[model samples]
Target: MRTFNMHEAKTNLSKLIDETVNGGQPFVIAKAGKPLVKVVRIETEAEKPRRRIGFMKGQLKVPADFDTMGADEIADMFEGKSK
Candidate 1:
């Protein structure tokens, strides 16, 4: 942890932010020798909400021959056959 005075923090805000995010070092900003705020990286992705996979599970049905269902038609089109 490091503490930066108001003027210094303002001047090096970008660099301080980079260090906080990339180096995982948090810092504090002070005004008139009193702490005003702390700069830290937000929670990582693992701590944030994630998409719910398989939310539609059981709402759709798949045929046993799903993979080959359109095989014949696709082959016919490629062979210039119509019907």
Candidate 2:
């Protein structure tokens, strides 16, 4: 990470963005030497989304009544009226 004052960031916004993107580096903008904010690259679409392994592999067990329940019953279930 690099630190830059607000004035420098504003005056050289393009250069700062270029530096950040080219080097995969982040920047922290500060006011009076106190850290304020960070600037970083955005994730590209090709980046695969992370998932928790076995998060639902064997943990999910849908009830037989899952599809048979009416809207009101589903709402009541969500509202804690049904256990």
Candidate 3:
């Protein structure tokens, strides 16, 4: 990662972008001597999708007839037509 102060970052944005895109490195731009925002390369479509394995295990249960709802029963819930 490379760090750039606000002035240099604003004045040389084009070079910064080129470096970010071609070099595939992240950068941080700071202002008032304080660390600020960051820029990084984006994942391409061919990249593997990120998954959280077993993140939801045993957290949810299947509901029987979950897809089956009468028209009036569904509409009444949305339109407050059911008591």
Candidate 3 yields a Cα-based lDDT of: 0.85
Candidate 1 residue lDDT tens string, 47-71: 6767999999999999999999999
Clashes of 1: 0
**lDDT of model 3 at residue 3?**
87
Stretches of candidate 2 off by over 4 Å are: 47-83
Q: lDDT of candidate 1 vs native?
A: 0.92
In order of TM-score, best first, we have 1, 2, 3
What are the models' TM-scores? Answer: 0.53, 0.50, 0.50
| Residues 16-65 of candidate 3: C-alpha lDDT, one tens digit per residue | 88888896588999998788999887867786878989899999986776
Model 2 C-alpha lDDT per residue in residues 1-83, reported as the tens digit of each score: 78999999999989999988887589999999999999998867786879878777777887888877687877898899975
Q: For residue 52, what is the lDDT in candidate 2?
A: 73
After TM-score superposition, the amount by which residue 30's alpha carbon in candidate 3 deviates from its true location, in angstroms, is: 0.1
For model 2 the local lDDT of residue 25 reads 88
- Per-residue lDDT value at 13 in model 3: 88
